[model samples]
Target: MASAITTLAADAPTLSAANTGFMLICSALVMLMTPGLAFFYGGMVRVKSSLNMLMMSFISLGIVTILWVLYGFSLAFGTDSGSLIGWNSDYVGLSGIGITELWDGYTIPVYVFAVFQLMFAVITPALISGALADRVKFGAWVLFTALWVTVVYFPVAHWVWGAGGWLFELGVIDFAGGTAVHINAGAAALGVILVIGKRVGFKKDPMRPHSLPLVMLGAGLLWFGWFGFNAGSWLGNDDGVGAVMFVNTQVATAAAMLAWLGYEKLRHGSFTTLGAASGAVAGLVAITPSGGAVSPLGAIAVGVIAGVLCAMAVGLKYKFGYDDSLDVIGVHLVGGVVGSLLVGLFATGGVQSDVAGLFYGGGLEQLGKQAIGVFAVLAYSLVASALLAFLLDKTIGMRVSEDDEVAGIDQVEHAETAYDFSGAGGGAASRSTAAPAPSAASKKVDA
Candidate 1:
């Protein structure tokens, strides 16, 4: 996401303590999203697999952070190498950068920028884990996280945001990460799931979420952190673009939540807590890329469209026979595409830049550029991710044995359960426990 400061960086930029402090806080907020995502995905799985699901997301925090400090920041934002990747001797291991050195023309230190972007890197691969939940081996997921970020995420980040990268140079308007983060993760999810196959039971099992309250809590945390994720992409609040993005993020999220609940009521005969949580996330995804450029009215339109489309898309897994366990493909892939493309239609030219979208009389050029960015990221991530999963499946194995899966992946993989029910079991603990409570049947019999 290029800003006016980025363009004018050649003017010998000075440090702005205010912007630096703002970005550090934003980085912290983004970091919280990984655990929030864990709770969100964890709650959606069966009780048998809840801990495993949470671990899938939480692992990325440990894995990606170490990798980011090493070469990830360099490959993503270092000097461009042939418009496909990046490299800089100064960025290896983050060793050469001084504490006070600002990032190019921006006021924030390079360290601040690196850490903020590091949060995005950590969460992107974690997103894929949701689609593969309840079946994949923990070791395989960890390996996949390390390899996928090395290959897919780093290069894709460069393409979308790095200086002189193809999409960035081509003027793709991914203000935050519709293409780089959401679409990239969503498409990779589809690819890996296709290779790894569905969960143990595809359609026959009930497989309902173990906890709705956990999902709601996670969704609430994500909503709170996203203000930083979106607004901070501008790098500074020197201009009001960051403020506009902040407003649009709220507007689109609210609209999407309402739209999703409305659709659920009509289509399923009830408004569910799951629907509310999922709809809010869909809106957040849709607004990520276009929030800075679109008006509040445009954000509403984008939210409504994304909420409805994603709500419908989640059902496609059943009809198409792909078991996206947690609707990652539906909410993220479809929502990312919707938000990225709408930028071409809803851009007001009054924000970000003087580039108007179709409705604002800028015609279809921006739309075409957006389509190119969207499809390019989708195609690459899908193919590469599938190949990675296939190799892992053929080698060390990606899925657990059917016996282990049925018995509960959490117990097999983590050697622990989310809750302890031994006290209720008919064993020594149960014998020792006092059970004076009586049911209506016992009361009637006693009477």
Candidate 2:
């Protein structure tokens, strides 16, 4: 370790062992959120399409990882390009990211930063898949993922976070990713849902989750991974801000879960596991931007408001006639907006950024800035995603055939099934129906 630091002496970048190590671990933690989301979304889907739901999320890690290394990172974080995007092509494929070169303010090597950011890039698109669940062709979906990131995510990331970016200059208080991650994906999900239309049965059939256990498990994993997701945005462990964020993340999630259960009991006369898990996620999303900025009390306030808003927002699909299968728009989009907007009201000075919010005597200026950031990203993402999905649907086709839809997407798309949701083994399969039995002659052969 000593020799490694000494070797880079000529660079004079002043590497910090603690920050470098913390960021790498944080990156890994963020990466886990994608698969965790798969289990979460998979559980929400019908058993027949559960595996396909899982695969939709899993594929993002594979596709986005490669793209980020190739040119995605360059276009995102490279030199300013008219304040709209980046253009230091030299950083493409990490070409100009020297071994000893440090990030602008931090001590970690730029490559470390790149890898960390790659995880964020990978997961953002995966968040969109749950809205389009069970109907998209895997190939078309893959193509959409690639194009959407290139067109929508990359440029918006530049606008929001890249050097000389407009939002950063305007002082948007994202803290983590209320705008760039949650709102962006949430609005994109809405746009695509408008284009794709509804699931086969829509309001007619009961689309209850196949596995509440998986939903709880996924929610548990998201709660765990979010520690890294929120605190790690500080870019180092040297500050107490990370500790504050850690506690805030926990408190807000707990508050939201409680609030959701209470709301469910009032509205439906019973608390539900699905409501608990979804509420926890809504809380996590709400705190992503505000946790670092708000007090623990503030976090609870944000949590309660987000819990109620998102809990109600999920019902919009029915009223407006959009088929957001797993409530990505409701939870992520609504939660993100709740968190971002509240930051302007809750952010007290003396925290990480030292920016006072409205309640702190900073007036409504900061809150207004937060609103601009939120709506700007929201509008751009919605338009771009709708156009992209519409084009894809028109050309190569987006939704599967009605035949494939009723039979199950896993069987139609992957030629595999999640499990015997049907009673295939004569054991009363899962929740749906019985799988077809083998021919009478080939019935286990008495083996």
Candidate 3:
């Protein structure tokens, strides 16, 4: 390590303009996902809680960004400690690194890598907001985000991606963040929801989505931004690994969407738009960790399995009596597991790493490694997040009053609503001043 640092100091660092620009764009793209998520989650909830749902995701943009700059980055990506956490005194407040110093061996500057990773840190806790929507007190949710990211997310990121991280040393094939981001967040969601319990009306209420169009719009934005999320993990396009990841991302997402529609038709007799959006997200989640490792055909197989499995998993909430408002566990947890494990089956030994999967004659060595990565992250995040939620619930409170929840979380929490029905004179005046109905002849015939 001393020799490496001495060598870095001896030679003037050269910046790769192309790689730096690419990483910057990717960071911006990732930053956009938080709002896309806000809309996606916002539309899935009832109108009464729409704004609150959106805020749940949006607040992370504010909170996590601040935390990441202060000490979050140091804990996550700093020098390794005991193979469990990391620390670099120089990285405190991001004050010590020179602007032009490259990120270890990478072509981009440390600042670029730090900012790009900052976006990831920002979105992770936001993902957890979906499961606790509508009923959680805004203050408690805020505190939970601060604590969860600090205790659970930062350490887990170190274990998965940091230098000398145990999982990274174990040869785990998470090119993106199947284990660190999705699985961590999903397991945390399950943990918190378990502590907080269900929404006011759980199985008894209709609880349908208030706006399908918003959901579709949010899904489209996520699909577009995900190119950056997956491909940018390669850090550079010099070798074409990023290109392969990008192609696999599209291919797998399409396959998952089709597979989900097919399953929905078979089981429910209709191909709903909600299924399409949900299926596409499942595909994206599944491919995030494995896209760089597998061929396009392997991507298709991963997508299909994830689509079907997630479609079925969403129903488990009802059977087991957990009110996961947004199916985070089904899509993120299940899809992440599917994609991470599939790397053991579909890796071609040609894309990102030289190690072959089972089909490629590599045996079960990689499969066991993948399982360790998956379960370690899931177990740690589950227990830690549950404890955090329980502590907050006991101290301040996690859930809102039942009366406030039923009336409208948006109004109670934010003093705002997604839509307003109170016109100047209300519904009474509008009814009295209504225009005459149109005649039958005025209506155009379909033919």
Candidate 4:
């Protein structure tokens, strides 16, 4: 019987190629999300610095990719060095690991895993830039990304995802990086915002998103790419692929969106497009950690709670004066916590091994474990991120000159505009001429 099973397993059609192809495609899908993020953030900033905002996200594609190939991957997913980092033995500069080697017992090339994981590395820090927009110096921001990844992101990724990681040893379940990605990024964002101080004329100015359409576009792309982000967490074509995660992703996002809009209507008397987009993202974040472990009903509960809690948290910046400019703390941090904790309550049946949640009558022990995981990730990320930010600030500076910020970063830093109608057509010139610059008097009045 053993020989028969071994023969069957050996003779089984090599699905490794197929899995590799799917994962590579998924990696590309996730890469597109950075540009989607560009649009998402670009739409939220004033037109003067819109291109700069977009560039911040796009730049990550180049910077993080290079670093990942160089040593970022080694530090993150390599063999465990200790509880905190990974060793550089397995694959350095893409050396020993072959295109055919399997990763995590999956029928995918190691390179496929590397590239796919690279996308996550690229986007995680980019997500934090939203909180520091319209103020940070572009050059300083680049330096910060480089250092931040090495010090904070790489270590955290190892802690949560790397084999023999401390968090993994604790049996913490993070399907798609609630602790590693969302909570990690969100906590860092809050830390940086506090360190950097508020953007000029933050609360006093009615600094609304410049283009609602762009925000909507980003949300759409993020929603689409999230299929890869969540489902790809499976890492192979497994039975789980057709199970809990598929339905959970859809229902959770929908429930979150409705909950967010409902809150907006109750509070502001109108369902704004921005609210819809943000709510969708909040739902996505909440579902990320629990998608593989929880049922559809659990996903709905997670999504609704995340949306409402995140919505409420957005108001915290104003009250507490932290200046998380784009509500990174509001959405990602709060939503991540909600999802991570709630999974303890709602995870049912045998979706995951070793333990079950409260709803499954596994009781409070699992809940305590979940809470410990959340707090541990939160505390480590916060302190480590703050230290990293401070080091960058002290060594190379973090924010730009006040004058450069007032004039906008597009022209001052990148020497480009988000929209150039100068060479387009007659309508472009007419539009430019028709728009009036805010007069000094008006600037003062608005200020």
| Predicted structure with the largest lDDT when compared to the true one | 1
Off by over 4 Å in 2: 1-13, 420-447
TM-scores for all predictions: 0.93, 0.92, 0.93, 0.91
Candidate 4 clash pair list = none
- The predicted structure with the larger lDDT, 2 or 3, is 3
TM for candidate 4 is: 0.91
- Per residue, candidate 4 scores C-alpha lDDT tens digits across 131-226 of 988888888888888988888888888888899888887878888889889998898898788777888887898788889999999999998888
Which residue pairs overlap in candidate 2's backbone?
421-430, 422-433, 423-429, 423-434
Ranking by lDDT: 1, 3, 2, 4
**Model 2: per-residue Cα lDDT at residue 47:** 92
TM-score of 2: 0.92
| lDDT (10s digit) by residue, model 1, range 234-337 | 99999999999999999999999999999999999999999999999999999999998899999999999999999999999999999999999999999999
Relative to the true structure, how large is the alpha-carbon lDDT of every model? Answer: 0.95, 0.91, 0.92, 0.85
- RMSD values for the candidates in order, in angstroms, are 6.2, 4.8, 6.6, 5.6
Candidate 2 per-residue lDDT over residues 157-206, each given as its tens digit: 88888988899889988877889999999999999989989999999999
Those runs of model 4 whose alpha carbons end farther than 4 Å from true positions after fitting are 1-15, 421-447
Model 2, residue 218: distance off in Å is 0.8
Per-residue error (Å), model 3, residue 167 = 0.6
- lDDT score for residue 89 of model 3: 78
